[model samples]
Target: MRYHVLCGIVVSGLLFGSAHPAFAAGPVRLPSAATVSSGAAAAASVPQQLVKITDVTNIRQTPSLDAPVVKKAQPGQTYAIVETVAGPGGDWHKVVLGEDKTAYVASWVVETAENKPGKSSTGQEKPSTGGKQPEPSRTILNIIDVTNVRAEPDLESAVVAKAQPGQTYTATGTEGAWYKVSMANGKTAYIASWVVTATTLSGSAGQSAGQSAGGQVFIYHTHNRESWKNVAGSKSGSSVDDAKTNITLVGQELGRVLQQKGVPAITANDDIAGRLVLKNLSFTQSYSESRKTILEAKNTNPALSYLFDIHRDADVPRSQTTVTINGKAYARIMFVVGTGNPGYEDNAVFAETLKELLEKKYPGLSRGILVKSAHQGNGEYNQSLSPTSLLLEFGGVNNTLEENKRTAAAFADVFADYYASVQSKSK
Candidate 1:
């Protein structure tokens, strides 16, 4: 079977759930008319244009896919065009949703009406005023206590100010994962984007709190396209994969839950499978591909202390991979530690710690730890990259997304407790 072949050499088993934590949800309020009337009047001179969403896509806080999603837009939805901006993945249309509210949608996913398509008009729509056109203003709400405001975007830069929880600042621009804000002295300061929730003054509101800041933990997926049987479509096989709905969503949920618990985390959603196809590499080299992503994240944020490669187990019996606690169903979790690496023992201990924690908080949710040797599979599973790294199998392919997400929340709950305990001990 494809399942056995695809997942072979990776199974070394150890055994290791919670109520879903409440997530912050609501629409970001639109800016007052007085705050943006001047810019709106300037935009009036340009002919009104609109774009219809061609596919279901997220309207993000910023142009980047990594930016928090403000809301989901459906097909046939139309919005007034604001301006086009060049972003990370592709060109994006900044569309006005309300009198003073705007959000970004990928240009490729929307069809423009009464305008030339596929051509970027970034500078053409600027107000006729000799001065620069007004950029979207943003309010950064500090979610953590006592985060530093730096003179530059790098962490090594000198700290110029300090921000307290609930404090808000006006952001002028973004440089990487840092936000540049105007300080009281009329000079600008940089703040780590992960430490605060940002609401664009003219754009839609994002998560009111619990925004991802590159924290101590990094979550990613080596097999990002793995999907459940229900969502994977009519493909008749043990292995199911999808481009849009996949294990990456589980990683994202884990990151969000970690953030909500005050443990800052970043989740990587790189298409490793697609990369393999492009490079003409086989499935066995999945770890080799994901390692590049992990290295980039570690280089960008040296503070990353824990690395988790999330995945789903091959076709296993649904009964074996699920459990009910407090009347809610959740996918069971298993930790796989590779004994091929020199520091494999440390990874095993870390996995054990998490399993024990889960047993205490959400009993029967963890299947226990499994150890694999070099002969068993890849045997390394990239655990050598970090002593704290482990390959986490969230559930089997038969499990549902809702079950996997519940497992993520439960894991995040215990992980936050574990993180707090570790921090306390270090102090």
Candidate 2:
């Protein structure tokens, strides 16, 4: 009953949630990354494109933290800007990494080198820029305070609109100390530079990815292509390349549930079987293929405390693996612990704790914890990286996605209870 009420709050919050002002403009969002991945090809009339790094930062291949790190940006260095994107994480500046390659940097780590005023030590425009700088990009800016939007670029111009803080607008161009904004009523207005912060709106910036601040949980699939009857819409073999209907969806569900419980988490969808095939590794080496992603996720988000390798069991009998609760069918969950690593006991304790938690909520929901040695294959399972990692088998090949989601939700609730207990003790 309480869970459903929380669900209502979360869902409603999502529905009415206004984005945090992408810093001083109004509470507005620029074009999302999926909509603006590419920019107009036409070159600007002498565009000033330089991004100066203000802090040591990482350059990523893509805007998301899930993407690979392409390079590290040293502090106080300036790089040529290629493009700017509004991604899930926030505004990412795509800059030149090499001749043709590009990498993304967080906007917070860098400032626009082109934004330097033409004034010298004295307060007059330098003669070099002809006293009139070129226009700025169509980037977005957040309004941080109540600012006046004038009809003309000059402050003496009539006040056409008043822009409150926490709103975002596209900067069509710029004049000395002023940004141009196009109003919805077809009027062009100029907002003073002092009350706004230049930034691109993105979902990632100042936002937890899934769960909570500094608390990330990793969810992945070792045998990602493993599917079920109607639920299994991938390949006919043990592994499928499709992410839509394979074991990846179950991992996604687990992540979603964790997020709903205020646990920040991300689900990885790497090609486990494809990597194994390329390396000429046996099917049994599937765990090896998944190890790289596990390490990479941790490398990108060091705060990740819990790691789950979610998979479907190969039990042939549907009746044996399925549990009926509240007239709804769900897949039973099992935790497998590997005892070959230095942190093996910690992993076992995590699995046992989760199993006990789930069983307390819904009796027989968990199949109990299973301990495996080196003889059981990949017994280490990279559990050494984090003592809180677990191998979760959710139902068998005969189970459907519906059943899997139900169990995933219940598991999320149990995990939330455990998380609360841990948080209390830490305090």
Candidate 3:
């Protein structure tokens, strides 16, 4: 029996180091009486304390000894201290390099102003009003799907919280490239500066210094187990299915590419076929199981604006599903738009926009948009979730995984441009 392609898709840390010999020849400078007094006055006006370099040391990207040295600090050089992190070798001080930059220095090489001898009990020795005024706090806008909030301003530090896209946090200060943010739990955590944009929050108007746009894009697989001929090792038939090697990998690749292009995306890897078996449902009910997954994702993240149900086509010849672009083989893609939903026109237009973008960039890489009705497989494909929803078939069963991945990257390239254009218009 020639198995036809089912559109609804059945399927399926580092340590710290010690000072080096090169710095040993130089005379180490400790905080003098005048320096201590100046540091004390500076500390009173700033939210963070100041630390003086006690020895010639290297400032590192992280709190570990093996971390890359970002700068060389000489003795007597003073930096405002963001916080102290305990490393494997010893405690490391996170210090501010500039307005939005920070670095780490060994605790053994730096001395805090408060640690000086003859420190007053009531802190009366320091003049409070004469120091530089503190800068106004800014708001942090997370542009990624999820980012780790570390206990310290280092990647090796423990993750204390998770920041989500479209969410804003109060940025208290900055260390190197890390933002010291006040978390919801009344505790402060550090988020990498690369994943977020710091903006000044204007009073009452709720306006940020930068543009706050780009909603979350959700990608999931309905037929999660759909596999290719070479990877699944199937001897015959039109399609293959595997639990481990499947279409979900393509979805993940697409999500990764989107993230690299600055678009916030989340890829869902729920086992739809396995869930159906456990629920005693048939393969035809794959969309039903995947719908639950979509709804759950939507409930978890209301910022999700673009929804995608990724699948692999079957029963098509290898020649039809594969294409050569720039001397590299890539699995051709198809956009399947279901007309069963009330707002499917919007979905169709969305799919058409993507298809046009894809074809313009990589000609013959797209098989065009396939309009389907209720009679043609599961017509809705859970696209009613959003007007921008789409069902994408990223190659056929006859194609290889590598081809699918290449096509995923190509599609992400097109989609990212399209997404940016849309976001620009919305502004």
Q: What lDDT tens digits, residue by residue, belong to model 2 across residues 385-418?
A: 7888888989888888889989988998898888
Best by TM-score: 3
Model 1: which ten-residue window has the lowest total lDDT?
11-20
* C-alpha lDDT (0 to 100) for residue 47 of candidate 3: 31
Minimum summed lDDT over a 10-residue window in model 2 is located at 33-42
- RMSD to native for every prediction? 18.1, 18.3, 15.4
Badly placed stretches (over 4 Å) of model 3 are: 1-214, 233-239
- Tell me the tens digit of each residue's lDDT in model 3 across 313-388: 9869989998999899999989998988889999999888888888899999999999999999888988898898
TM-score of each: 0.56, 0.52, 0.58
Q: What lDDT is obtained when candidate 3 is compared to the true structure?
A: 0.68
Give me the overall lDDT of model 2.
0.63
Each model's C-alpha lDDT? Answer: 0.67, 0.63, 0.68
Evaluated at residue 405, the lDDT of candidate 2 is 88
Scored against the true structure, residue 187 in model 2 reaches a CA lDDT of 72
What is candidate 2's CA lDDT for residue 49? 52
What C-alpha lDDT does candidate 1 achieve relative to the native structure?
Answer: 0.67
